[model samples]
Target: MSQPMIDPFGREVSYLRVSVTDRCDFRCVYCMAEDMTFLPKREVLTLEELDRLCSAFVDKGVRKLRLTGGEPLVRKNIMSLIRNLSRHLDSGKLEELTITTNGSQLARFADELAECGVRRLNVSMDTMDAAKFKTITRWGDLGKVMDGLRAATEAGLSIKINMVALKGVNEHEIVPMMRWCHDNGYDLTLIETMPLGEIDEDRTDQYLPLSLVRARIAEDFTLTDIPYKTGGPARYVEVKETGGRLGFITPMTHNFCESCNRVRVTCTGMLYMCLGQDDSADLRAALRASESNDLLYDAIDEAIGRKPKGHDFIIDRRTRQPAVSRHMSVTGG
Candidate 1:
């Protein structure tokens, strides 16, 4: 008889996104409100514990590791963590070592990061308008982000622009932003906003769905489908060879759960099955207790088992459940 998987929720877990810090230098309105609580220091996992978690999961089946956070670069010793992961992780098992940053401090660490192990870097820059930029990030400067992007690109990191399509805010700037990235040979991915935990709810309508966003861009440039690569989320198309590509992630408009391979690890060390659902296994507690592989594997098993049939948010013909969170950044959307 086949061995039955035994995880918290009891499936094989893969694709771990490790959030390194709960602190971010930028105050994007979507993630934090004036009264929102910052992640307290006691709850965050140490670098060693974080490293141990990755080491444990590599054996189980984790193939993709994305370093995320309120902003990962804000972490004190990110390069050290990157270098450690580069050495300890079996690159054969962990295929992608990437990061999602707000680009506020990337320039300071871009080359160091490339030297450590990161291949591709995704920078979240929604609009190029200086006034709007300040307004959106709430006192953050755009020039710092611009400098960071240039430095990372120069350091040889494959760059992708991650723009959240918030209507009446950055939506109108979409075409200009796409053209700029396309001309400069960088991939631009337009993301739909998800109402998940930690996402400030007041600006929910600002999220422009992918279909409408794509149609708006198509009015100017023609897009031909880029064939499937690794089957990761984004569907890619090119703008005829200015050297860049356009990628779309339609999470809110079209769910891609059939191919979903992602398992998330929050900064606090819980392994989450889905973004909207709160079912998680406490890997941190296990790590602290000096648990063996059996317990470690058990945590992975439990987390994967809870991976819902799908994150179906729409109410069409069947009953729909509410989402897991009120924001996206905390969940690494």
Candidate 2:
């Protein structure tokens, strides 16, 4: 008698993460091989279609929206997209619109983004050492990324630096890097590598658990657990007098899927209820067919209905099967 509710696992679907594009400029080795084949441009959905889908989800009671990408900044006319979405949804209801980027292209666009109401930024920087950064990212210019960070902070964006803890690679820089981030008024997070792609080299040398990372940092400076859970997986810790804090996301060894309130929609328009799950519903077809708002609403409802209780990340890790075939860049990390 009633419309079937989607993603009602305990009766809620509060977050929507939309990836504007599957293409990125960076050649991070772990994200993707430098020579990896990318998704063809024709396969990508139009920006109009993306906005329609986002609006339909909002109509269906989804509130939070995060724009992700192979790098969302690379998407042309991104300000128009954000402005359009901001127009359709009312203020508090839309809640927040944030993006996570590699920071190479952000320096050029940070001001425009600030003008468009993008107030938060999460940047990925694995190491401060220029040589090591170049090695890990395969010639990704480190100076450009730093410039992006500086520009974002200057734009008054809430900044968080996301670092992947690769043992022998960048783990040694953990304390100094976090200290740097704090000194500069930025939040720092240490994320463990997930079993997403191939592992020819054991980069797990710095595979120290979150507890260990916290302990090491705590030894140097006293850490006070920042009161509330600040969304996502990271556990926030603050220094007594410092304005910034450090976050630790150890999803590999610790699972936060149960509380995961996020869903990913790739640039091509496939709605993935859970990032670790392989299957997703393609909504681009319906979007291009007709501009029916109800149809769009139902499509979002259907996608949410199919959202699983959680993902099989822990299980897949044990089996040694790749947890995700498309890699983080393609699927929007």
Top TM-score: which candidate number?
A: 2
| Model 2, position 253: C-alpha lDDT score | 71
Q: Give lDDT for model 2.
A: 0.76
Give the clash count for each candidate: 17, 6
Task: Tell me the tens digit of each residue's lDDT in model 1 across 188-257.
Answer: 9888766555444444556677899788777877788887443357888887735468888887787766
Which lDDT tens digits does candidate 2 get at residues 267-295? 88888888788878878876776756665
TM-score per prediction, in order, is 0.89, 0.90
Candidate with top lDDT is 2
lDDT at position 107, candidate 1: 73
Worst 10 residues of 1 by lDDT: 1-10
- Looking at model 2, report the run of 10 residues with the lowest lDDT sum: 198-207
* Global lDDT of each candidate: 0.74, 0.76
Clashes of 1: 17
Error of 2 at 59 (Å): 2.0
